[model samples]
Target: MEQEKMNLKLDMDVQKLETKKLRKGKHKAEEDLKSLKTDYKKLRLSMRTVGLGKTLEQWCQEIQEEKIKVGRWERKFQAAQMQNRSLENSLSESQNERDELKARVAELEKTVHQYRNRNSVVELKASFGRIEQMKRTVEELEMALQNCEAKIEYLEANDDHQSEQLHYFQDQVTKRDHIMGEAVV
Candidate 1:
């Protein structure tokens, strides 16, 4: 009975040592699970940060491109403004030239009208002078014709009287010749 009691006490001590070892192993496994969970969370946070950084870079690049386009458009606008100003100046010069030409044309028209009026007055005066000369010539020709008619009438009357005297002389001569011839016979 003494040997059996000693063996029973040794068995009890071995059971206590096994219980302590089991508890230590369980605590180690729980610590390992927690470390794995922490590592997963860190990985998720790093992935999100990398994705946001790429998005920000893309936005910055778009903004830079837009700025470049705006600069190019501004230069084009300035050039167009300069061209418009030059065209306006050219238009003004053309208008001034047109106005001057109009004034010159009006002056020339006025001069032409004055010359036409003077020419008409000179022609009227010349026509009046010609009419007066024609009247004087007609009067002189009529008086000369009357003098010639009077001289012709006088010459015809004198010739008729001379012819009557010549016929009387010839009859007297013929009667004398007849009386002489009778005496001779």
Candidate 2:
């Protein structure tokens, strides 16, 4: 009985050790499986990122589409360049026309200024002529006024002489009348 008990205890200890080893091996296998799953996810993400997930035909098709888009954009860019050149040319023409117009306006203004100066000269000359004519008229009027004054002075002197002659004649007539009356008496 004692030998049998020893054998049984040893067998139990051996079973415990084998259970512990199996548990450890199962935990390590689970960790390896988790690591493998994470590596598989990273590999798939890398494949997509590197464009390796698509087939060669799909890549070729996408490249062809991109080339078509590039061609279209190039055409549009060329057309825009042509339009820009046309606009630049038009702007240059407009600027030239504006410069010509400005020159014409300046010329017109200069002509107007010249005409105004001529008109001013003519007006000044006319004014001088009018002033000269007025001066002559004033001189003639002064001469006529002097002559009229002289005539008035002569007429006044003649009137005074006539009044004195009349007074002397009347006095002589009265003396004759008085002598006639004395003779008659």
TM-scores of all predicted structures: 0.33, 0.36
Candidate lDDT scores, in order, read 0.60, 0.64
RMSD per model, one decimal: 60.0, 55.5
Q: What does the lDDT come to for candidate 1?
A: 0.60
The digit string of per-residue lDDT tens for model 1 on 81-178 reads: 55555555555555565556556555655655665677876755555555455445445544544554454445445445545554565475557545
Model 1 segments more than 4 A misplaced: 1-60, 120-185
Backbone clash pairs for candidate 2 read: none
Error of 1 at 145 (Å): 77
Model 2: CA > 4 A from native? 1-45, 48-51, 119-185
